[model samples]
Target: MADIKLSGIRKSYGSSEVLHGIDIDVKDGEFVVFVGPSGCGKSTLLRLIAGLETISDGELQIAGQKVNDLTPSQRKIAMVFQSYALYPHMTVYQNMAFGLTLGKKGPLGGLLGGGENKKMIEEKVHKAAASLKLEPLLKRYPRELSGGQRQRVAIGRAIVRDPNVFLFDEPLSNLDAALRVNTRLEIARLHQELEATIIYVTHDQVEAMTLADKIVVLNDGYVAQCGTPLELYHQPANKFVAGFIGSPSMNFLEATVTDIGPEDIEVVLSSGKVKVRLPVLPGDLALDARVSIGIRPEHLQEGSGEVFRMSSRVKVVEQLGEASYLYLENGEDDPFCNEPFCVKTNGHSSIRTGDSVDICAALSAVHVFNASGIALTRTTTDSRYIAPRRA
Candidate 1:
């Protein structure tokens, strides 16, 4: 296991800087995931750690050693790319043992002088194959295996190296949904057995939420938030993270602060009819100051329970097996502004398009962001209405 640390890490390509100064400390055997939209510098950051890209500035330490000048092999790091990157001409065993064989050749052209080296390579290959359940297909070529099998071989090849850190760059992106789930479980199992420090990069929040011990959310080449899944979900640092981490995204409503109290603040929506009292810290909020309110779809319920009720017109209704998404039509100049505003209802919901329904959002579920998009801390008035807990 290894601890990876990045202090003021920065990356640049000519005049354009991709990664602004960023810092992260990944503990030994911790599963840390880098997640963000494309062009957010997640992949760039991973490559810098893997020695694939040069760090323009800042320091990177792996296992208590500074390795900014080291090669990938010198860093003792193994990476699994999105593409299998396997040689079709080689069998599974040959592919897994290839690295060891090349290493035995040393810096010069001559091979290692003993039979023990070959035997050791064979032992490591067999052990890795067995662990990944690829023993039966050791002699099979890459063409003979499925996509998921190819990925396992890729992982097993990395395992044979016994590297200090494992880097995964969207390893499961090529698999089908069912295979993705199975491969995800297999990876989770591998982490448990190996207890290896892993840095994974993915744009999929679901993968980040399910697989990571800690998640680093990047935005526009900067670290937006870094925390556990529940922390980012319940207590986002800004509006960007608040809107990105959740499914269907959080509903954003424009409102102006009308009343500020010690515990709760009242705001009037832009639509003029809805007035809400949200339990958020009254930090520098003044009357008539425009602020945004965020609430998750799941938190908006049909009935009231320490909630702020509002009448909405259902523009559309989509029924999944267990839940339904109700798209509300709020009066606004641009309809797209309200596109993110929707409510998740129970599966058996009878509401339909063009129907008027009353939706209530629990006070604790509301998120308040100031004009600068910074989230204000929420005050918990009732324990029952605390932020939604992760299951």
Candidate 2:
């Protein structure tokens, strides 16, 4: 097992800087995932750590050794790519043995020396195949294996190298959805068995949520939020993270403050005529101060709750079979600008059409933000926004 450390690591291409100075410490035998939208420097950061891309600045250490000046081969790191990168013509055994054979040639040249060394290499190959469940097709070629099996072979090849650290760049991206789930479970099991430190990169949030022990959320070449899945969901630092991490996404509304109190603040929708009291004090906010309110779809209900309530024109209704989402449009110039605010209603609410109806939002479930979108702390009204605990 190894602990990987990156301090002030940076990379640049001419005038465009891709990775800002990033400091991350990956604990020994931990699975850390780097996740973000495409072109966000996740892959670049992986390449820099693997020595495939030279760092424009900063340091990378593997198992307490500084490897910045080392070549990819000298770094003793094994990487698995999205394409699997297997040689099509070589048999499985030959492919697995290729790297070891090449290393032997640089020194003792195993076969030219003795049969015992070759036997030792074969034993290690067999052991790795067993670990990945690839022993059945050791003699078969790459064309004989399924996408998942080919990936297993790729992982097997990495295992045979026996490096201190394992790096994966979206290794399961090529598989279909169902296969992806099965392989993910297999990988989870493999990690426990090997107890190896792994660094993985993926754009799929669900994959990051499920597989990573710790998730690093990146955006625009910088770290947005880093935490366990629940932390990012329940307590987002900014609006961008609040909107991005959830499934149906959070709801945003522009409104004018109409009432202020020591314990609660009331605001009217910027769309006009509609007002709702939220779970925050109106202190320091001007009487007519314009602030935005954020609430998750799950926090809304068609029926009344302990706190705030609203009314709007139903623009679009979607029944997800498991749950329901109703979009409401308030009176405004641009339809989307006065776009339908979303609410998570019952799977069988049975409410439909031009329903100028009232909706209730529990005071605790509401998140109040200032003009600049900074989230305020928990208030008496917000005390009710309790997260559903996982059993």
Candidate 3:
């Protein structure tokens, strides 16, 4: 496999610039995923790496070779798009073998004669099919296969090319929920077996968290943060990364600094009922300064806790299989300024809508952010909340 590097990459369309000075490194056999919201230029960045779009500025290297002017074929990268892009008339075997036969001259134009070349191509196709579990459907046409089967065929086609790098652009977006899960697992397994360098672009945070060895979060054509999934989730650089990387999103509550200590700062919520001592550096933060307190839904528990507590009326209760999300009304006077506080509880929670409840969270679970939405450096040394490393 090959390593890919992008330095100060920029992309523009006429007068408008999309990607601005993005720098990233993908080591050999590393699976790096670019994740962000819609219109974040993730897809455009992927296209630039695949040589489908020209870079307005900066350098791109593959396997220690500069390829700014090289064509897609010379870049040695295979792309699997959201659409299957399969040929309806051709069987799976023919579809996978088409890339090997392209631009072939008479007698196969190599040391291996025409017969030997054909055999070689057949072997490659069969091996790819076996790996993807598509051997049974090799003779079937695209129209006869299910959506998952068709997608597997597309991946198998790319495998036969033996590319130095693989590019996947929302490859599972078109599948159903169940199919997407199964296909996602299949792709992860394929990565483990092939150990190919891959760059994937997706708007789904769950996909990004579960698949990537490293995640680069983009926003407004700029790199917000780049780190492992757990690192981004537990220690976000700013409010955007913290909110975007987690499911059920983090809840932001208005608060003011009450006191500052050597290794922590104390803040009181707007309601004046909740006071929390957060383990963060008090960098230039003064007393009575306005700040935000970020707490994840999973961190908030019913009843009282050791650090902070809040009493709110439950507005909605969503009962999921393993857990339930409690949407509590913010006690603030102005409804427009805040969203309902959310708490995740056990699936068998007896709390119902319209019931008054007390929610609590530990000080270690709280994240402090400045008025500008930049996260403060946390001083807590606990690793319990961080996600486990991938096997």
Candidate 4:
């Protein structure tokens, strides 16, 4: 187990820069996940750390050693890619033992002969297989094993290396939905057992949220935000992070600052139907300054009574057994017309398409972003104000 540190890490292809000045710290035995949308350079950054790709600039240190010029094999890191990359011809045991066999030199560089080396390799393989529950399939070929089993074999191969760091690049992308869940759980358990320093890259936020001790959210080759899952979910640093971390994605509505208090600011929606007093630092916000309000689907409740309320026509309703999502139509005149305003409600909700519904959210649940897409500092308070109901 080793700590990994990246300082101002940058990557480029020809003149086009991909990762721009990224800095992250992974403590020993920590599970850190790099998460973002497609083309966000998360995979590229992982490759850089694995030494699979050369760093265009900045420094990368693994276990306190600078390894910018070290080859992938010399980095003491194991990588499990999206594709299993397993040997179809070799049995599970042979595949896992292949790396150890090639590098085995004993104390005198092969003077001890093959017998002792072979036994050592066998022990390592068996231990890894048992941990992953792959012991029963040790003699099976890649073609004979299920997808999940094959993925486990790949992970087991990495385990035998006893690497200082482990890099997983979308390892669950190829698996089916159910397999992904099971494999994800397996990986979590494996991390707990091995206590290895792990850096995982995935486009799925759910994976990052569930597995990572810290999540690095990348956007357009830059680090958008890095924090615990709940930190990014509850207190996003900016509007982009706010929208990207949640499942249904937070809904945004255009508003202008109508009033500003010492500890809070009041904004009225562009539709002129609702005004909300959000517990946000008023900063240099002037009256009539353009800003946006973000509310998560789960935060928006059906009916009224909260501090903030809005009425909109539901365009679609998706029944998800335990819960239902209502997609509300933002009028053509609204700036957010391109995006649907979604509300999560109880599964038993009778609300259907074209139904007009009044939804409300507490002021504490609202996120306020300035015109520049930067989120204002939201203060913690219990003060609430009831807005007048529209006649």
Candidate 5:
């Protein structure tokens, strides 16, 4: 187990910079995940850590040693790429032994042409194969193995090296849905057994949420937020973090401060005649401020069973067996665009589309943000907002 640190790391191509001073720390044996949309520099950061890309500036330390000048092969790091780059013509055994065979000091040094060297290489291969449950298919070619088998072989190849850090670059992207789940479980087991620091990169939120001890959410080459999956899910740092971390995503509604007093602010939405109360101290709040109110669909309840209620016209309804989302024709400014406020109703819900209904929301479940789309520190309602924003 080793700790990896990046301080003020930056990357650039010509005059256009891709990464802008990213600083992250991975504790010994911690499984960290980098998640973001495509072209968000998640892969670039991984490459930089693997020494595959040059750091434009800043320091990279592994196990308290500066390794910026070290090459990929010398970094004591192993990377499993998305493609599973295996030798098509070679058997699994030969492929796994290739790196060790090229060495002049390892147990497999110059072994392909001799007896003892060959035996050592074969033994190591068998051991790795056994670990990955690939011993039965050692002689099989890459093409002969199924997708999952091939992926295991790729991981086996890395496991044999016994490197300090294992970097996975979207390793499960190529597998089928079911196979991906199976492989994901396998990775979790492998980490428990090896207890090595593993940095995984993937755009799939599910993967990041499920596998990481901490998730680093990146956006436009910057760290948007870093925390446990539930932290990012429950307490997002900003609007972007809130919107990006969830599955159905939080619903945002345009609103104005109707009354701002000492602790709570009153807000009114265009979709309903009801006045919604926001629990936040008015010290930092701007009166008559243009603001946005965000709430998870799951937070909005369908009957009189909730703490607060607001009425709206249901525009569309999507049923998913376990739950349903009611898209309401409710918005002041295009908070969701007719993206409609998705309300997750109960399983086999009795609600229907176009049903004019009263939706209830727990006051504590609301997330209020300023017009700039920055999340506000919500407190219990006091009273401050007394007027709406002037046009």
Candidate 6:
């Protein structure tokens, strides 16, 4: 296992820059995930760490040693790409053993013809095959295996290298729904058994939430937020982090600060007869300042709370087996959309489209964002509602 550190990292192509001064410290044996939308530089950053791309600026340190000039092999990092990238003509065993055959001198320096002994390669290959349950398929070609089986072979190939750092670039994206779930579990198990330090990149927030010891959310080439799954969920740094981390996403409504208090601030929605008193300090926000109120779909309950109340007409209702999502009509100035606001309700909810219903959220569940989209630090005089600080 290895610890990875990046300081003032930047990447550019011609005059356009994709990454802007990225700094992160990944602890040894930790699972860190980089998640964002397309073109957010997640994959580019992963490649930089793998030594597949050159870092235009900044120092990269692995296991406390500066490795800015090291090649991919010298970095001792193994990357599992999205595509299996398996050789069509070679069997699984040959493909798994291929890495061991490559020597610093040349292809001729392989175990079959050069320095490394045959027994060492066989031991590593058989161990990896057993670990990935690929022992039976070792004799089969890539084309003859199922997608999941081929994926296992790809992972097995990486496992045989005994890398200090493992890099996964959306390795499960190519699998079907069921296979993806099963493969995800397998990867999690492998991490626990090997205690390997892994840096995984993906656009799937669910994958990030499920697998990461720490999750980094990137937006427009900058890291918006990085924290544990629950920290990002319950206490986002800004509106972008709040909206991006949640599944259905948080609902943002245009509001105006009507009154400010020591431990609470009152705001009214622009196009609705709704007023909310949130548990956050006003700070530099003046009266009548435009702000946005963020509340997750699941946080908005059916009954009204003491601090907030909202009523809207339901436009659509999607009933999943576990819960129902209600799309309600809202104003044009709303952040998410013009017509409908999403709200999560009980699976057995009787509410239907065109029905008028009231929804509310507790003061503790509400998030307030200032004009620049930065979330206000929440504070409450009520000790019961205040969350304990992380040690």
- My TM-score estimates for the predictions, one after another, are 0.94, 0.85, 0.93, 0.93, 0.89, 0.94
Q: What TM-score would candidate 3 get against the native?
A: 0.93
What range of 10 consecutive residues in model 4 has the weakest lDDT sum?
A: 382-391
Model 4 global lDDT (CA atoms, 0 to 1):
0.90
Error of 3 at 209 (Å): 1.1
The residue-by-residue lDDT of candidate 3 on 1-391, one tens digit each, is 8999999999999989999999999999999999999999999999999999999999999999999899987999999988989988899999998778753444545334333277889999999999999999999999999989999999999999999999999999999999999999999999999999989999999999999999999999999999999999998889999889887999888899999998899988787767778899989888999998888999889988556787788989999979999998765452212777789999999999999888888787889899998899987766765555556
lDDT of 2 by residue, 259-306 (tens): 888777888776565566776755478788878778888888886654
Top lDDT model: 4
Candidate 5, 219-306: lDDT as tens digits: 9899988887877777677888888887788887777788887778888764445577777665576767877777888878887676
Best first by lDDT, ranked: 4, 3, 1, 6, 5, 2
Hey, what RMSD does candidate 5 come out at? 6.1
**Candidate 1: C-alpha lDDT:** 0.88
In the range 1-391, model 1's lDDT, one tens digit per residue, is 7899999999999999999999999999999999999999999999999999999999999999999999998999999989988888999999998788766445455364332288889999999999999999999999999999999999999999999999999999999999999999899999999999999999989999899988999998899999888788888899999988989899888889999998789998787777878889888888899999888898888865645777767888999969999998865542224554689999999998998877887778889999999998998655543435545
Poorest 10 consecutive residues by lDDT, candidate 1 = 107-116
Q: Name the lDDT value of residue 319 in candidate 2.
A: 95
Model 6 C-alpha lDDT per residue in residues 177-290, reported as the tens digit of each score: 999899999999999999999999999998899999899998988999988887788888899999998889998888899999987898988864677678897889999999
Model 4 off-target regions past 4 Å? 104-116, 333-337, 381-391
Q: Mind sharing the TM-score for model 6?
A: 0.94
Which stretch of 10 consecutive residues in model 2 shows the poorest summed lDDT? Answer: 381-390
lDDT per prediction? 0.88, 0.80, 0.89, 0.90, 0.83, 0.87
Off by over 4 Å in 1: 103-116, 332-337, 381-391
